[model samples]
Target: MKKILTAGAFMTAFFASSAALAACETDVKKDDITAEQATELYECIKEKMREGYGSADAPFSKEYQAWKVTATAPAAPGAHGKRFLITYANETAHGEYVKFSEERADNPMPVGSILAKESFGVTKKGAVKAGPLFVMEKVAKGSADEFGNWVYSAVQPKGKVMKIKQGFCHGCHAAFEDQDALGYPVEEVRLKP
Candidate 1:
């Protein structure tokens, strides 16, 4: 009886753990996102962005550091000719970036990929001014290049969505249709281990 009870308890615990892991929505959705998921995603990245720009109370400062800096010196809206930095959130995205030149149209960022363009300005005194944070998330499967699939949003440093538009970003990036609507020249990204 004791053996049977122990086995039953172990099985129950295993199943419960599996269910909890499955509930984690790391993979981006193919179509529209649930309000809850959108909120969570926004909040998570927003918090990270806050810390990346130096927020004392922010969590996950080290976590954001793992993100690959794919591009720097890219032109941005309000950078005032200073430059911009682009970072990818995961290995899958970085892999796509590393192979994009060779694979061309064949390779694209996976579902969970998130790209952030951290716009910053340089002062004469060599101080850095953090600008708007632009984020692009690649949704799985479908690719009409809109908010539902490839979402685009610009966020302020304090976690405000300055803008969330699809056609504006998609239309410009769509010119690079071979690279899955990506704008940055990832061929220059020095892939780190």
Candidate 2:
């Protein structure tokens, strides 16, 4: 029984180490990584990301992937700490959100629409780093008047609800007055309307 227990422990450690080593990593600078390469990396890490987020027991984390993907590949932009971000739009948000419209004053995102963005970063030492899952949900008119009627929240990489300051997120998003505070993905990866 002792030998069997030892073998089981060894097997568990081996698999854990294998999983750790299997993480996606690249020496190439983030800016220089091509869409194909980014997609490849995404494929390698996406499942782990989903599992991590889903561990939070949040509806969005588990359901976002079933929604429409807004970009072909993750994009690294100045926003979101320059991490690579791939966005998803729920059914309520997809039709109007996909328009990537710049006419928000008159055509705002419908109430109930939700957007989820998954992020990841690469370190200077070439290690792939998982990031939080950002979420924005549109509430009924006047519900969250201070934040353009949208609520911003996040889930940590380990599935904890991240503490988010509404004002901080809104401060930057407010710059996009024409897009209803929506910051679309960079053009290179944006899916065609």
Candidate 3:
């Protein structure tokens, strides 16, 4: 019995370390920071975060009541995959959302608009497990190098950044220049009032 228990413990430790090392394995950008490192930075901040980027505490849960889904087909025919649900902070986005359609990609949002996007994985059982929350808030001006003035950050359910490719986010959002990088399906946006 003792021998079996010792071997089990050893196996568990080895696998845990292997997983940690593998977590940092990924392509790096010019900055030399791997997706793992960036995710680590994100997770670290999320762990201690008390508020959204430009908003008060618990913006999604407390402040925003409903989330507007922006996927081409939120109910995709798959057991597991990626999907997006979005929400806006101010009335400007809501106004645009109320009348916007996927065909109308020219709806521009004003500054000071905050968008909270919930990104999660779908289980093979069609259940929702813990996932990341992506937050983007439009600012007065963006750095010359960024996609737009909108600041982007992602946080996991436990509060950490999920690993992703460099420019993995803005690269897609860039297509919506007229909409200030809100690449969601316009027709999918919704709010109570």
- In lDDT terms, which candidate is top? 2
Per-candidate TM equals 0.54, 0.87, 0.49
Candidate ranking under TM-score, highest first, comes to 2, 1, 3
List runs of model 1 lying over 4 Å from the truth: 1-65, 71-82, 123-127, 143-148, 186-189
Query: Which residue ranges in model 3 land beyond 4 Å of their true spot?
Result: 1-81, 84-88, 101-107, 142-145, 161-166, 186-193
- Please provide, for model 3 over 51-137, each residue's C-alpha lDDT reduced to its tens digit, 9 standing for 90 to 100: 332233333433333444333322212211343233334444555554444544444456666666543333444333334566666
Residue 98's lDDT in candidate 2: 79
For each candidate in turn, give its C-alpha RMSD to the true structure in angstroms.
16.3, 4.3, 12.9
Report the error of model 2 at residue 111, Å: 0.5
Q: lDDT of each structure?
A: 0.53, 0.88, 0.47
What lDDT is obtained when candidate 3 is compared to the true structure?
A: 0.47
Compared with the true structure, what per-residue lDDT tens digits does model 2 show for residues 112-151?
9999999988889877778999999999988999999999
Per-residue CA lDDT of model 1 for 18-108, tens digit only, reads 6644433345431233335433333334444556454423222234456876643233332223343445455657766645463456566
Stretches of model 2 off by over 4 angstroms after superposition: 1-23
Angstrom error of the Cα, residue 180, model 2: value is 0.4
